[model samples]
Structures are given as structure tokens and as C-alpha cells.
Target: MLELGENPDTAYQKIKQLFVHLNLPERLWSLSPTTFSGGEKQRVNIARALSVDYPILLLDEPTSALDETNSKAVIQLLQERQAKGSALIGIFHDEHVKNQLCTRELTFGD
Candidate 1:
């Protein structure tokens, strides 16, 4: 918190919101993420990446491992990030996800 120049309370609130949005429970916080399921780990990675309010975010298959419900949650989070003027660049195999987060696309010949 001190290193990031963010207030502890404010940081906590941001993380708390991510937890709720990502469906991360308090119990999982104490345990190592190595024990988590694929979807759980994906959410954890999303949480970690969003924890910092960086100007640019590089995402790859952020929603690939998730089901429709969880994928919606992840897309919501990405939309929130994009709304804040973050430069998001990523590879999204899901057409819906790509359409949601990307403003432009480039494709190589198959």
C-alpha cells in the first residue's frame, strides 16, 4: 500500500470489490492458490492483475477457462477497466469477449 502510494482503506475496498465480483471467498485468501481449481486460479489471476491501477493491461484468454456466468463476471471487470481509460490489449478466442473488450482486431491468414 505504502509502495503504491494508495491508502490502506481505499486499497482494501478495491480488493474487497474484486473479491465480490470475482466470487472469491475469505477462506481462500489464507490458502495458497496452487491448490485452486482452473477457474478459481483464473479469477485469482484476474484479481492480481486488477489489484494495481496500471494504465495498460495485457490480457490473454482471460475468460477462456470460465463458464458463461464467470465469464460474464470477468468481462464486467474488464469493461470497468476499459471504462477507466486503461489501454487493454489481448487475445480473446471467444467472439463475444473479443467484441466486448476490443475496439479493433487483426487476424493472420489461417
Candidate 2:
């Protein structure tokens, strides 16, 4: 992790811990690029992105294919990021997802 406040060592440790917290030990190493389910693959994607430690995270319909439980987990991870002073920009079509996660809404139209 190379973000402003996170040390690489600490970020790596946290990421490892998150994998455990998410109960994804088996999926962590065996996820094939073409064989992952949406939620499982999303977890891996989030892990990779967090490894970068960017101040802002942009997600495009991150939970689109996830079940309720997995979506909640991802939301919790976003909240953690917010607490760390990182900004998250998530693109989602699910009303429940936006309503639960965003403080303000941005709408667009043609």
C-alpha cells in the first residue's frame, strides 16, 4: 500500500487479515481469471485495489452480481476506507446499495 498515510507493510498485513476476515482462504489463491463468481472475483479485485492504497477508490457496479451477504461485506470494507480518510466513488445501479452507502446522490440525465 502506497497511499498517503498507509505504510506498505501495514497495508499488506491488513489486506491479509481482511482475506481471513472475509473467510476467503481457498478462493484467495485458486481464483482463476475466468472461473471466479462475481462476488468472489470482486473480493479479489478489492484486495488488489487495496494493495495499491490509493486515496480514492472507484468502483463500477462493484456489487452488481453479489448476494446480500457479500454486498454487505464490501460495504463494510468501504466504510473502513472512509474512516481511513480515503474517498470511494462507487458506480451502482442498485438503489439499495446507493441508499445504504452514500451520503449524497449524484444524478445524471440526457
Candidate 3:
């Protein structure tokens, strides 16, 4: 963001959308993550990662711990990122989700 002349603080405000999409209660914002539940922490992890504009992202089972609704939300956010030309490399054990998000597949031991 600095290279693009974008203020990191202002750009980081995107986290609001992330938290909303990931179903994190706004109250989680003021509290320490150590006190959060596993699911909440996982949602935070997803939100934190998506808050930045990295050229390449490496993900491993991003939605593995989420419910169907949350998983769909994550997929929608990822699709939007992909549409904006972000490169996503991930391990998706869920074939349904894999089909939804992946355009090209790199398989091993096939």
C-alpha cells in the first residue's frame, strides 16, 4: 500500500468488511484474541489475512473450521479478491469449495 501511495491505516479500514463477512461480532474488535473461542480466532485469522492487498496469498484449508454460511462468505470474499487479480494458492479439501474458487488446479500424486 505504501508503494501505491495508500495510507496503511486508511486501507486497513477494509477490515470492517472482513469482520462483517466473516460473521465476527464487532465486540471482538476491542478484546484480546487470547480470550476468543477457536471459531472466533479462525474468523479473525481469515479477516486479518484478507485485510491486506498482497499480490500472492498462500492458504491452507481456510474454511476448514467454518460452518457452511461462513465458508460461503469466505468464498465470496476470495472470489472478489481473485476478480481484482490477487493470486490465491490454497489447499482446499472440500471439492465443492475447490470448484467454486479455483480456476486452475495443480495436483500432486495424481
Q: How would you order the candidates by lDDT, starting with the best?
A: 1, 3, 2
The positional error of residue 100 in candidate 1, measured at the CA in angstroms, is 1.1
- Per-prediction TM-score: 0.89, 0.74, 0.85
- Report the error of model 2 at residue 82, Å: 0.8
Model 3 lDDT-worst window of ten: 1-10
- Winning candidate number (TM-score): 1
Compose the digit string of candidate 3's lDDT tens values, residues 36-93.
9877888898877777778878889988888899989988988888999999999988
User: Candidate 2 on 39-74: residue-level lDDT in tens?
Assistant: 676777777776665799888987787778778887
How many pairs in model 3 have backbone atoms within 3 A of each other, for residues 3 or more apart or on separate chains, i.e. clashes? 0
Q: Extract clashing residue pairs from model 1.
A: none
Summarize candidate 1's per-residue lDDT along 14-50 as a digit string, tens digits: 8888988998888887799999989999998898899
Candidate 2 local distance difference test against the native: 0.74
Which residue ranges in model 3 land beyond 4 Å of their true spot? 1-12
lDDT of 1 at 40: 90
What TM-score does model 3 achieve against the real structure? 0.85
